[model samples]
Target: MRKKTTIEILLFSLIICMVLSAVEGSVPILPLDQVKAGMKGKGRSVFQGNRIEEFDVEIIGVLKNVEPKKSIILARLKGGILEEAGVISGMSGSPVYVDGKLIGAVAYSLGTFVKEPIAGITPIGEMMSISEKRKKGPVFSPQVPVKKHLTLDELFMLNKDFFLSKAVFHSEGRALKPLSIPLVFSGFSSYAFEQSRSFFSNLGFNP
Candidate 1:
């Protein structure tokens, strides 16, 4: 009887450990409907020196249907490095939590020259949905030559669809081309820059 009791206790302990492990791995997300305006939260991001720090988040309100069925969380941030430098460009994907629940990530910047840092939070649900789709789909595979010898007209013809899709037209009818990615070159020759510009430009990238 003692041996059977010992076995039962061991099984119970094992079951408890398994339950705790599952809980730890799963991050409980707060539903968007539950989030209210004027609620306070904390955001985590790496500011400088590779250390992730916390900042204060004051909820303004949720922007519903901003992007065709997708919504965003609008919040005013205070404290941390925001006091000195406003919103850092590389701070995107910084996870935000409200009431100890995961809310979203710091995705959009309101303005550059503004004194206060106001940002748009891409909801955690949206991000998770994106991740799920990516996991289930085949990865993107691009084919490109080592040296692109295509002319400007040829390049334009080949990538016209991409440029058209990315092109943003303002109210004044001015075409605002979106930069695919930002590249920085330090101490590189002007000739090198000019030569590489075609390659990058053909690949729908901004150099």
Candidate 2:
């Protein structure tokens, strides 16, 4: 059966009101270890004009150890505004559910300029760890809180120093990096964005 109900919730951000919604009620989360390829699912996110909408997701497979203990799940998306916009950048962290069971968050895109709506999902297990860390404190990794109003470039520079300091003494003798943070650039044209990429990259950002 297809679900057609829409629930809207207002999310107030720094500069705008973003409306996000999901189906009401509790949904059991599917464990990462039990997720398999070919399973069908549904994901929810804001697609057009701040309206929350639903989309389809079909699991392709799980890529293990993509970065240390971390893993990524590949899934092809369909339906809703995805047919028009493809996998959008702002849709990151959209909740994905399989058989009414929560599976993961839409975290990455295959690339720009793709005809297909393929996305990389961050497993619920890994996402939960991030939430747990946040609960323990606002300061992730270094236990030091940064002051407000720092730009994206400034944050990257601070994080680079934090990672280097940890690399010096990790018991495994390897660097322990933090989870990736989303970087959003608004109101920039292709030429301007390209020109500014190097400026951000030099500050230890991937751009």
Candidate 3:
């Protein structure tokens, strides 16, 4: 009886390990070092409401050292509404996969009024590193006291580091900024809405 129970325990542990391994194998990561120019992939995002859609992606090349110890994968996206919309807002953080291996997320695009669907991908490794750091501790700990009511100027001063930090990349004389997301407001008077819109616009939001 003892031997039978021990065998059952070992079998259960083995099954759990096998299940975990299979799950991990399903989504394999394509390291940045292996990515190259002209490689093709597919990106997934929600172009419309709730439903996820896929678009074709072709690697333009890699921009090495775009930031300190960081890199960005330059790719041209096609298909779906990408041709008509040209990398729509809120499409950032969309996953791109190459050869069934996860590569990166769509994060940056050329400024408004451009035609092509060119985008910059933030690599999976760097994203994972940031995620791990987040699990360890808070990424941003403000020095300001949270219990106190603050004016708009005081609030801005307290979080100025976060608000002022914008990562801009240049390509062919065009600046690449994070995709602009539309801001919708409700339950506000016209004057209040206008003031709020102007405030967000100054902070680089589409309002």
Candidate 4:
């Protein structure tokens, strides 16, 4: 009787841990229906110097990307509300939530120094799709017991400093001698760089 009770208690404890693990590993991507054009919301952006800043943003519009329509929200730092922040140099991956539902994350800048100061808001769900390795399958391999693997977010963050260095070069273009600065002096936002690469390539720019 004592052995049976101990086993039962252990089994119940295991069940609770499994449930919590599933919830912890899962990421919430905003449902398509929950997002729309011109939605107003609050957003959080991580900037240079490892600082996080929050702001108010308005959804400018949605662009259809093959299948998923992407949400593009424009934001102004709380301090610069009226003039427009133009999605500062290092705010990519900012999370935008509307009425408590996360709608999208800051993906890239639409253009440079535009008067209206708009930034491209990439739906978190859409960006998530890029990081997804497989379709219609369990996220883990059954053959091998699951151990903590690098998450898309974690991997990207680890490479963040490298990305920022690239951004510095792109800003100055010709005058900015790539060799003039140490590798540590520059950076690139993955979101912005990828966006530019895609946009230019689509227009027939050379590789």
Q: Write the per-residue lDDT of candidate 1 for residues 1-207, one digit (tens) a residue.
A: 334333323433353344224223367788778778999999988777789899999998887765454677778888887877766666665778998898877766565455567777767777665555544654322233112343444434443432213323221232222223344656757965775576455544457
> lDDT: which is higher, 1 or 3?
3
Q: Give the least accurate 10-residue stretch of model 3, judged by summed lDDT.
A: 156-165
Which candidate wins on TM-score?
3
Instruction: Show the colliding residue pairs in model 1.
Output: none
Poorest stretch of ten by lDDT in candidate 4: 176-185
Model 3 compared with the native: what TM-score?
0.68
Flag the better candidate by TM-score, 1 or 3. 3
Better of 3 and 4 by lDDT: 3
**Residues forming the 10-long window of minimal summed lDDT in candidate 1:** 169-178
Cα error, residue 108 of model 4, in Å, equals: 1.9
Off by over 4 Å in 3: 1-26, 138-145, 150-165, 183-207
Model 4 misses residue 123 by how many Å? 1.1
RMSD of 3: 14.1
Those runs of model 1 whose alpha carbons end farther than 4 Å from true positions after fitting are 1-25, 139-207
The lDDT per prediction is 0.60, 0.58, 0.69, 0.44
List the RMSD of every prediction in angstroms.
Answer: 16.5, 12.2, 14.1, 14.9
Model 4 TM-score? 0.46
- lDDT of each residue in 1-207, candidate 4, tens digit only: 334333323433353344234323355556655666667777775544567766777765554542224333343334343245544544544567788766665555545554344555555555444334223333333233222442324323332322212221112131111111111212545754453343222221222
Per-residue C-alpha lDDT of model 3 across residues 4-47, encoded as one tens digit per residue:
33332343335334422322345789999999999999999988
Which runs of model 2 end up more than 4 angstroms from their true locations?
1-27, 137-207
